[model samples]
Target: MSGPRIDPSLYRERDVVPIRRALLSVSDKTGLLELGRALADAGVEIVSTGSTAAQLLEAGVPVTEVAAVTGFPESLDGRVKTLHPSVHGGLLADLRLEDHERQLDDLGIRPFELAIVNLYPFAQTVAAGAPAGEVIEQIDIGGPAMVRAAAKNHANVAIVVSPDGYGEIRDALASGGTTLEQRRRLAAAAFAHTAAYDRQVADWMAGETGQADRVLRVEATLSAPLRYGENSHQRAALYTFAEGRGIAQAEQLSGKEMSYNNYVDADAAVRAAYDFERPAVAIIKHANPCGIAVASAKAVDPIASAHIRAHECDPVSAFGGVIAANRTVTLGMAEQVADVFTEVLVAPDFEDDALAVLRRKKNLRILRLPADYRREIREFRQISGGVLLQTADSFDQGVNSAQSDSSAWRLVSGEEVDAATRADLEFAWRACRAVKSNAILLADAGASVGVGMGQVNRVDSCHLAVNRAGARAQGAVAASDAFFPFADGLDVLLQAGVRAVVQPGGSVRDDEVIEAARRAGVPMYFTGERHFYH
Candidate 1:
């Protein structure tokens, strides 16, 4: 037995009466009181323990406390309440097996037909960074016991783990009783519920005790089933892990079905938009920022700005891209967005007038993410056989710790860079490391003037970056996503009159490349972080 089996055959026999009691206990009492009332009304006794019993009594439902049903008083801070044979026998007894039936009859044991349970919110508690005592208290004990017992004997009993299943339970009872299929589904829910809780506990203990070698184990629940996966041929779903809520859980204001890529890049773009304090637009293509601009939304609000600024960032790449903003969209924003094409737009809000204009483009997708969207991020990546999960890659770029101050190399030989200029250079470097392979970025002031990505070679990227600038590349600082790897890229920038360069200098022929920069009298600095996207 690999723990507990949840096979369909295990629940094949559902005709038995169960003398069959239904045990109910849950911390999330969303539908519990109603379920308790229904079970009791059906002449199926309701056995509960501690708080559940108190809640049932308060709700005017007649519930037999475990102590009353088992003829044993609660003990040891109530830990010993439901572990007795009176409870287990009812849960574990096999009604169909003759010898077991005879033994149960002789021993005066009555089997339970249903176990309605929802575990303590251990995941939420741990995620809240709760104190040790409180976290320990939240770990469920008897609930898992009853659920396992019921699930183990699913052929005789039905288990309901989610409050959402309360309706199905009533419908089943109304139509005589639950079918074997229903029992199996409930069993699977019971098992999955317990497993997720257990992983949370294990992860908590590992982190709390400072276990360096321990790996973080995670389990998240499916909040919604996606229409399809990366392709329409595959099935997909969205699993939530941000303390049970996040932008992923945000309601859609207006949109068609969000495709797999839309959700992936929309989340990425939204988080990136919140990185800076200033009002900005982040246009993301294929999960990477293609154009990021700090601009006035034509007016004060983002929706209006979208009208005027949406396509202004980069009209071509903005097509089918995802847009995110930290501020509300204004009418000017709406007008800006109205001109260009995009697949999705997300923000803290959209003004009524701006939204009205946006709605004209009926097929465009829009989502109002939670007000506190940046608090936590659950990043996920696909693997061949499983998945790789982590906290969203940390957004802190350590802007303060820059190599600009030191004379590691010369930016302008004798011309000392001022504090303001150094800040610009540092910010440009961050934008550089964030771009795609063969990537080159031209930064003037705080915004990108030109960006070249996914080029064949470093020289090609340099030409494309400067060419995109048209006339702006002159005197603009340039940054590359990786080491030059050769001097041809540098020669092209010198020809374009780019004054400064930033890149990761880790090539075997780095000295040669550095010598080339020295010859061109152009200052080139190396950022250790190499960003590569495939």
Candidate 2:
């Protein structure tokens, strides 16, 4: 089944190739004029297609239309322009090989020394919510073909795919030609560009045809290089999907460069804060919320009040933590936040006065979230062998599939809670989802008074929550991310004087837990849904 192998010695090796002729076709015309001028001044023959030819002619650069060289009209609405043998023959011919040179000479074809090509705006068109027909039209067939042909023959042809390399290409041409090393680098970049373009097209078509799960092609560009990863010794960098949303796209207004841990904690804080409808604030450390709170309905300064209450939950842990606000940060919030040794503050926006106050902290990072920011539905996690994918845990899918509807909950023990107590239970339940597995949260008056997360057992989480809350644990409602397997964890919360509890009740010993709650004279509600964040 294998084809014959060719001898590598048959082909000639080239180091630097002079630019005697060039082909130009691009959708993104950034720096095209400058490049064309440089090529024309170098006395290089310019052959182009469609708009590129028109623009070069308009700029007083002599150009030969691709159709003229191919001896065929550009038919099929310009899609067939560069697919002919003449184009590929020029691009793919290895001038160093006598066979390829003789074939080109016999066919009266001139080989191109360089190719400048950028594909159509397929990704941007799809992202703009364009219609299927319009999006399909943006898929460039000829461009990728020519790019691949030129890249495969990089020893003879230099392929330029991005305008970012225009200055270098121009300088290289002025210096006589592109070096073999430069050609190799450009070929690598050209192939990457085409691969990403094909991925976007494949992803869009798969989704449109209802075969999205059949394929997964993840593509991202390097955004930044971090100082270190989780520790100083580990190396790391940030790669973005380039969707112009989420923490990857958040604008940093001030402060030191974000570290690997800072981005992780900041993203967690944003997720926790935005989970609630009211003005809310979340202070997070090590990807776990140290404190979280929402503003009361009648609060004068909602965001400020939320921050003050959130910080009170566990001020010691909140120190050097990342803070995220659902609402804009105002002067009142910033003034109080300035006193804390915070690492980062993220919000949708910040008032001028607030920015002035927070900017005084030299080491505090301030980030403004994108205007169209929203939580992504799909989540990906890497393991040792492969990767894990799942739908993100969302508050909107809680209980009866209704967002924070207390009526959907089943009160299995004691008397029903009043509206205020019900609100606290709802707040606690939503907030608990942001915590890691074996999570326990205690809330009162719309604020988290205690939080215990990342524990191995439920009983230890209960004890930790109570210890953090101290006196505040009395009369506070508790929310568990999962059901209590035994009565021991429930007993700990009851001993702390927790007035009510909420959890997904599906354990075989649910009866024991309910009986324990009844004995403590506290109410317990079952959500019939568990949120286990690993």
Candidate 3:
């Protein structure tokens, strides 16, 4: 399976490789014309394929078609134009190796000092929801072959894969050609480019053929290296999917760089805020939501009202927390937020006056979400030796789904409450999903008044929620992320005078829990679904 290998001693190391002849084939023509002119002005012969050749010719840059060198007409809809040995031999030849040089001379093939190539838009086409046939046609073969060949022989040839390198290549040529170090860097980048392309194709084909589980390939480009991770002792950096749209793509408008914990809490806050349909806000600390609330439909300055209610849940914890809003941040919200010490504030957008007010606090990190922000369907978690992948905990399934329709819920005990209490129960259920398990959330008037999360036992979570709510628990509705195994947790909420409760009912002691709620004269509904977030 291995090809012929040349002894290392047979070839000499190159310091600077001058471009006498170049091959340019590109799908992205961003800097093609300028690069072509630079090479042409340097008297470097340009050999191009199909559209690339036509583009150079139109731009008045002398170019020879690849078919001219291969002595083969364009065939297979231009798919076979550059696959011939004449093209690759020139790229792979090492002039220092007399054998390679003699073989090129015998075949009348001129060695190329440069190869500029970018593959077809395979990832873009897939993301655009193109059909299978069209996507297949974009899986480039000849381009990757030439790129790999040139990159492998980088000691003799300089490979340029992106327009971002055009200026450097031109500058190097002006200084007497690209140095070996420059060629090596370009070779590394070229390999990465081809690797990402192949990953996209493989992943897409896996999905199309219903074999996603057979193999896994996760690829992301580095965005930045943080000052530190959760602690100074840990190291961390941010990596973003090439075609992803999320917090990593968010624009930081002001303040210092984001830390690892900041990104985690900010993402959790955003997810919690967007879980509601109305204007909403979420305050997060340590990847857990301390408070989340949605404003009434008729409220004026809705976002401000949501922020006030959310902050009221636990003012002590919200002081240095990360805040996220589902809608635009306004002047009203900005004024209130300015009074508090906050780590970060993220939103879809901000009013001019709001941004001006927030800018006064130099340490507060403000972020404007990307225009195409969206929630990812799949989630990944790294374990000791492997990764765990699953569908994200979403509100698009089970009884209490995205519509937040309470009609689908089963009332197990007491009388059904009024419309207002029903809305509060639904709001409580949605907000609890953002909390860590065993989770408990209390809501009143579309705002969270209490949250107890990350507890080892459900009973402790109940007591924590009741204690946090104080007098608010007297008439508030409570939501448990999962079913109550026994009546002990339900008894804690009942003793707090909670007016209503909602929990997924699938416990062996469900009957006992229902009996307790009946005795307390409190309405309890079963959603037949759990939202554990650990």
Candidate 4:
């Protein structure tokens, strides 16, 4: 395919253009007073609309209202305020065209050299759980129109769409006006801002109307640059969505900057910690759960016990891993972790004594997740050519039912699970879901004994789990994200002395697998729901 031919004459290259007049209208009003003062100091005439005009007037800045400039009043509840030909003609006129210049003069429309606008908070309204009517009303039509017109005529007009852009615009105007390059950059930013706004409205409406094909769109802002990606050779950065919660929202208390792998592993660890109601801890390495444990009724110190037990699951792998706890970190718990070389620790809060001890390790990263933080509603994955979107794996979904003795799970073979074993099986299943595909998780009491993740075959996962557990596998319970393909995989766990098993049984050889468990006198339960994290 041939590339589109470029027309050199359509483009004008210049060093700078002086600004004589500007139109300012904004919903956020951020930096408006400062920007107005700066424009006035530069001898630039300012025109504004509605509350913006009133605000500038109160601030003692001379300004003209949109209605005064257009000779038309706002109608349809202020929707038609800036849609006049006078406003658009000034914005669209081409300086190079004599006919366009003459037309502006013939209509007596004052050309605006600059436009400052930011659309209404439509996405914020939706996120606040506003009613559909209120959300629809928040969508700004005139703002986007003005932004597009100003952006399209970048050769003559400059556009400002964000409060962060105010400094550069003020600097340019104060230093003998803006350059062609600066105007082009600002125009591109304006277009992108409007485009994202439109996408948010479309997605919100599609969701309301039950549209079948929901095109995944994410408006994520860059949070920070990471030292490296999965490998030192690759490049990566972090992006935050909505109010920028989750991993990006976590406040770093003390330590070296978090790397790409640290964020990945920390995210997984925190998710696992959130699954349990009691005092729990999860240790993760390479985006896989190496250890997980919940406190039992008999434990005197729940937090410390949970941390110690979790660290005991795979002590070697836990050396440089991330640790996440649901409860606050106390001095005693900090003392336990202080013995090992941990990379990161995340929790709701940390006591002063705990911080004093943990901060001693200068390179250990510590993060505190906000108390009101909620998981995102949708999950996204990038594929080869496109993207995949689905509802997030919520804690109340299929997995949580088994914890409450819901009928969604059925005992398939051998014998009914006792109360203690059932609790372990549920805990194992929760941890298993956090692991990668082809996962097998083993648990005893309230702690994960072993975990096998990202294996190609079910049998290999079983073997990996058994090897990691060692003697701990004897009489331990296990959870599988999916059904075993054949009797061979079940036989491996049975021979390893896994007393009880939980799986989502929907394989072609389900009968054979059940029979193998029955013959081995191993109890098995079917959750009727698969959790494949790939």
Candidate 5:
């Protein structure tokens, strides 16, 4: 059967609605008493459910229980208290329609002018490592129902989903009542709140069930609006999720606002800095590391020495670049870098004297990250149509110098490496992982002498590395991001005094490459896995 057609003239928007009755149910009791008192002073009736009614009564505010309005007893552990016709009918009534007004009067239902609700702590419970049964019990059903119903009738009802908006709600009611525009804004906020809650629950359940190919639904709130994107003409903003701490969450104590290029280079710098256990520093230009160095065992001031070595690698390119340090920034290191024009500096901490010294540079950004910051985070990239998701490149963390048994490497030429040479080789391999392919790195004495990256051919990269290193290339170890397609690449490194090499041996001409290293008397090892970052 079809219902009677409604006239278009009957539907009209209400500019402001006076509060006659309201439904207030919340798990978070913040600002409840204040809102309740404001409504009471305005001569509005307050209806609540469960312990909320008890709290309002204790606060000397008049309240009507939800069960009393529905004419039914609370059942199913208080879950069935607000899922009745009286509540929905009041919330969904069309205030401008004559037929709707007659139906409400005949059913003895009073329309609700406001709905204040906040859902249960399902996300918090899951974060605390609760069991499945306990986490499932925290999901609220009737709360979302009433919230959606009130949001649908936003023309007549005002909705508030967060405690931060209580002041706005109070001022709106005090200045007469809520306007239509205010109600519409509140409605939009209510929908976003529910959507984020549901996404957290879905992601948790998918992980528990071992669903590998689950759909990725991200809900991020705006953190900041940048001055511009990669270019001056493009617009951009920053958004953050509810989980994990990274460069986005770092504390910026002093400096100007961050630009889009600053964030990109800062993230890449930190990813390389966090891979080493010893005190180290990485100087990044654009998105690639121009210089990388760790402290030597016998240095008096290891952190300062590392900074000097890194800065000396390519002083021209290091100007106005982002720098990352695994240890604290000290006065000595600050003095060493005072002459260069650095745009940003990130470290675990900064000494009191060092901070004061660096503050002289008015435009330098200084960030203090958490001590235990790591790179074991999920990565996402946006393309033309959709997003690509994968785990970050963190296998470098498990690489160790002394424990050669864990590596899938086999010595195929020259002789086995000593302890010190093996250590430098491990450092070189981890540093190469952060550079863009085709990548080649040379290191000696726990510091990178030269690095060649973002080149098209492997032979050109070797030439660049050798040219940068000059005399320092002698007796230095080398690491390649992938296997050499031809033996000439290995021969070039060997001729430049590269005594040892580490790379993923998987090319069809692996035998030929091994023979070339054998003739040059250079030891070579294969890691079985590649670490190309393009």
Candidate 6:
């Protein structure tokens, strides 16, 4: 992870000795019986732990208990099982070093040629929300120690850390055992396993305490080496964060590789969908929302507008947009968007019926993220020799926690909103809050009619919204991710006939903007926080 440490040149032509003696201990019993039997059949002696030995015996696999090999039974609540010199000597002895061999012979210690081990389920238990006591109980001390020792002597000892390696183990044994190259690769895997395991433990503790010093998990996926970064001559590669929960983790369905901007905006659209209660879709272009709509949970083609609302917002810029949905994607929806020159369709899952239709558009990017997944994307961007690393606002806890506090976006209209209108306002607020900064949104009932985002200034964004809404901007509810910087921004809204406005009321010129709204006779509400995505 810290880049490759060992040089590839050093591993070439390496000599390896077959493993004739191995120490095997694992709390996870998966494939243990088969592995022990295979090693025994290959003429390798097996040293195991308490229940592991019992299980191997029951399975008719020849094995020696750790006590038999180390002359030390597990003590101190099973902590002292493999800490003795006998166990350590077997793992650490260098077969090629005469001094090490002489010392081992003088002490009558056996040099183990292989160590097969997998640690206790620390990450799995922690992830299951176990109590700290149980999690601590699952941490393996002796297992990691043996793994490290065996990997250190990988020059002579082969270390296996994963059950998936059983096939390679058998192959090695059948093919006159493993060569040194295989041992090195196995050792690399062993160390990576331990490193990942340790990082997991550290991250779980960090998350429990709300500590940020050590990342809960590093977010990274490798990208191909580029001919050049920024400039065509610079070397560059792309990477995706491997952590966080969300649709981003879905296996690739099909399409060209995602570009840097595609991923950034797709993340925005998906996170926005998580905020809405009902099924919703947001079509994003260039990191900003272009078309957004919501409907009944059972509504088909949720983004499709009714005849009256079809002309409410311009769909010209909606071309090549990334659309994300909260519920399963269906055929009706696929057909509607399939006509548009869309780039990607991301959803919780895609129905086979929908997939059957969407696949014909071979170039359309399709992604299926996990249901109820949350992604907190964080990464670095560089400009002019300066690098910036920032945490991405991928999920809104405020949106998710609205039952206890819709305090973030309170509608304060002079004309009281009836229940139906209030519900629509909340829906509109949720949809609008997810657009990019310098944003303005216009919605009729529960569906968006106009959206403008990421402008150089809020007033220009207002123009973009009003222009897009055209005549339909009249009498539509308006929402802003941030408050107007001055009265002129609202003047643009009033000229466009916006009836109601929602904004995070924290601008220094709020009084000027409010006075303009009050004069325009437009009701305005203030939600105390800005939902800005940059």
Which candidate ranks first by TM-score, i.e. highest?
Answer: 3
Cα lDDT of model 1 by residue, 1-534, tens digit: 476444444433445333347888788889887787877787777888789889999988888888887888999787677888888998888766666677888988777788888888988887797889999988888878888888887878888888999998887767778777778778888888787777777777887788833574555677788889888899998887745445687667886877888898887677656655667677888876766655542445533443234344356777888888778887777777777788898888889988898888888898888775654544457889877765443345444333432245334232445655555565566555445677888776556667788887989888878877777788877788788888888788878887777777789878888888788777777766555554
- Give the alpha-carbon lDDT of every model: 0.73, 0.92, 0.92, 0.88, 0.87, 0.74
Write the residue-wise lDDT of candidate 5 on 450-497 in tens digits.
Answer: 888989998888888888888989999999989999998888899999
TM-score ranking, high to low: 3, 5, 2, 4, 6, 1
Instruction: Name the lDDT value of residue 469 in candidate 1.
Output: 74
Clashes of each: 24, 0, 0, 0, 0, 7
Instruction: State in Å the error of residue 282, model 5.
Output: 1.0
Residues 92-115, candidate 3, lDDT per residue (tens digit)? 998879898899999998999999
Clashes of 4: 0
| Runs of candidate 4 exceeding 4 Å displacement | 1-20, 37-43, 58-60, 93-107, 124-139, 167-176, 179-181, 204-214, 298-301, 397-407, 519-521
TM-score of each: 0.82, 0.88, 0.95, 0.86, 0.91, 0.85
- The stretch of ten residues in a row with the least summed lDDT in candidate 2 is 396-405
TM-score of 2: 0.88
Q: What is the lDDT of residue 9 in candidate 5?
A: 94
In terms of lDDT, the poorest run of 10 residues in model 5 is: 397-406
TM-score of 5: 0.91
lDDT of 6 at 268: 71
The positional error of residue 252 in candidate 1, measured at the CA in angstroms, is 2.7
Query: How close to the true structure is residue 148 of candidate 6, measured as C-alpha lDDT?
Result: 94
